[model samples]
Target: MSGQAARNVLWIMCDQLRWDYLSCYGHPRLRTPNIDRLAAEGVRFDNAFVQGPVCGPSRMSYYTGRYVTSHGAVWNFVPMSVGEMTLGDYLRPLGVRVAVAGKTHIEADRTGMQRLGIDPASAAGVLAAEGGFEPYDRDDGIWPPGFSDESHRYTQYLRKQGYGGANPWHDHANSALGASGEILSGWNMRYAGLPARVDEADAETPYMTRRAIEFIEQSGEQPWVLHLSYIKPHWPYVAPAPYHAMYSIDDVLAAKRVPRELENAHPVLQGFRQAEVSRNFSCDHVRETVVPTYMGLIKQVDDQLGVLFDYLRRSGRDQDTMVIFCSDHGDYLGDHYLGEKELFHDCVTKVPLIIRLPGAGARRGAVESRLVEAIDLVPTILDAMGADIPDHILEGRSLLPLLRGAQPAGWRPAVFSENNYAFRDFVREPLGRPADGCHTIMVRDHEWKYVHFEGLRPQLFNLRADPEEFDDLGADPAHAPIRERYQTMLFDWLRNRKIHPTVSHAAMTEWTRKEESAGIHIGRW
Candidate 1:
């Protein structure tokens, strides 16, 4: 507490990793001893929601320390507004070294990155995008120039390792990557999760952790902020060796499968359950293979984490580094008939959040039931490092109060998440229909959830009576009052919010098709 406020912040983020998957949160099947240990070692927020269910927008929120709506990181593929302030901006002035690993959907252009103060020049790894690494190391094997898959390499790697499944929707074409022994340089051509299937010596995580350790080692004396984002337990359901065989479907149980009336409640959630229903997963190959494979992948990540932790401890930085474990977003791995992430269910929106503060007499092993959002990470880190809060950033609050065991007044007991079905131009598969024209926005209190699907009918659930959100109160006359209350709140939300206009829906669809179109990048070029 006496030294300068600069502390080494290691942000460990997982892709499509859910909150409930960790054993600390009442899941008996998911073996997350590392997360469980982290929960025990620090504070775990029971109700932590993400800014958005998808990656890009959520990552943007993480960078700016603001929610999607406020930060204007509206959807996937949209460049984060360069003019806006960022966590890097705050930290750089405070003498902190900011570095990113796995993913950064941050400002797409050079101007944006520089403006936000993201030191891409100092980045240890920038997997997909070019220009992140300066002096270049070809031996790294983490990336090949013009290599375009922006996410989930480990899962794709595992699928090629004998974890075969069909793309019945014909939506997946990367299955051939394994057969040909030819790696597809682009995003859709190669399964994103496949990279994790490599051996420990060659795998991405070990390499990444090694890089983290190396960065820390090289810093003879510098306050570093390392964002270690791991892509695992994601899609393609492909896991490697013992991990690909770790647990069985018997070992992995299903989430609460409620009735289907309230199911149609959100168009943002349409095609969700069916999308999860793969004729492949949960079958013999799946039960004996897929589930265990995912567990194996998770454990693989955990092992690397343990390695990174060991490095920190051995270097005497254990108490000096404030570690945080979280995820960009959660996945719907067969939950509600969804294969990947599109639905706004708790399964995909609620993420594991553990914050470990480094200081004498700082509270440890405290589990706070307060609701928190992923967007809060930026400000929290900044506050922890004693940085100034730029007045323009307004979506999230500093959690210094909660960490200090003081629940300050005026704290909203709810968290919000909004995702436009039409705006995610960069991602394929979770197709969006204009007629459906669904816009989903959620406001959840401790015991209730208010879900508004703009063009479709709304959904209201009493989490106290139906934790599964099975019973819809929106249509019931008896609950009409509650609906009105939520509706008013939704309006109030709009009143205080600024909705950034994006490229039209047609523009989005056109871009998506072109980007995924057999090497297509533009229309009528």
Candidate 2:
């Protein structure tokens, strides 16, 4: 095996961050200098999309390097099958220690473990959780009562720091202190204006940063992949003291929507707009009050990233480490009359993807607009590490060639994203169709985007003409050819390809031979 100079990988993912929110990505008011610096010194992918728009399945794709359908974890809380392989399962055997310092959103395959007679509380089970990443510090980012005990470590750390409460994650990290010293929980969006109860340093983003730095500092003698995931700019928009007040209402961007977008909406989307998360952004007052805090949260993440980058340089590991910055998915943030991501809009699917290699000075500050998917990260990292790419198991192609400033011939012409909102109970809409009918697929190329819902009308936008996606031409007969072309593409994209190919080629060959040698084929003959 050839030893790669970029042995260490720092995979950082920010939750619910929009692609355009960063200064490098053309956010006019929000100045993300640290993240922008990554763009300045690395390869920035202008059009990187996630396989799934929601947290769980999106992250499953990132961790497993497979699509939601292939992994069998199509929605939040759905367990990835134990038979499936993960990044750790592939990398750890090659002497690379894969560890996560933050959320993976990976649900453990408890049924598989139980059937296999593996103790769920054992070290093996914990490692088996989310593709077998050794938890340097795993926080799933949900801290409500009974939501998860894995996050109790963070709560305990907060208690040690004098953040007292039954659930310190809610009280200190998520809540604000009113003038009367009462807890103003972040659940109330109106309270987003108030500063968080905890100090800025003790907030979730900084805390996760510190934990990641500690992991890097102590990961002695082993070439490792450290996933530093941040749950900022996701929700509970209140930031701590200084960050909370960093931006004012005036800094908030106008909602990216037109009044006419409501015309001819799909049933799935009609239900999405009425969902609690989506409805919150519909109020103009909520948009104005909460957006600044959202910006502050992003700024806080950027500042912490600065700390992380500085630490790498000071530790003298900057030259041998690969730093990748992206998000699981983007936030709608009131775009298209929606708030949270579940739709196929650019604001929800297109994420900021910046990759900084250790010695990629030749292509430094270069930008690649070729269509890329979040699933591509795994193969790319493995290739960068000089490990064998598992061609049969992984569906994404490596971006190493693109990173080296070489354009491969015959790259994918379009990108795709999917969502299964119908299975989710949070969306309590009576769409008259079964849960499977709520599935939606999006196929987008350079100029047009086509969204197909199983039971509702399709949506097509001439992206070149309507960048904001204000006009839906699915109903226009003039665009029939365009719609048909994209429909064929989508159909061909999801055609009868293997979703489960667990057995190796040699094993399959042996099994087929054995079956043939036996009298199994005699009756058929």
Provide the clashing-pair count of each candidate structure: 23, 0
Query: RMSD for each model, in Å, please?
Result: 12.0, 2.6
TM-scores of the candidates are 0.77, 0.94
Evaluated with lDDT, which candidate comes out highest? 2
Off by over 4 Å in 1: 1-6, 107-197, 259-268, 273-288, 423-437, 497-525
Candidates in order have lDDT scores of: 0.62, 0.85
Backbone clashes in model 2, listed as residue pairs: none
Q: What would the per-residue lDDT of candidate 2 be over residues 1-525, giving only the tens digit for each residue?
A: 485738799999998899999999998999999999998888999999998899988888888778777787888888898878888988888899899888888888999999998887788788886568898888875556535353457877888899776788888789998888888889888988889999888998999999998998898768999999888888878889898888888898889888888987766677788877778898788888898899999999999999999999999878888899999998887888898887898998899999988884337888899999998999989988989877768878888888878869999898888888777555535767677677788999999999988867799999998999999898899999999999999999887334656756567669867888885785673
lDDT of 1: 0.62
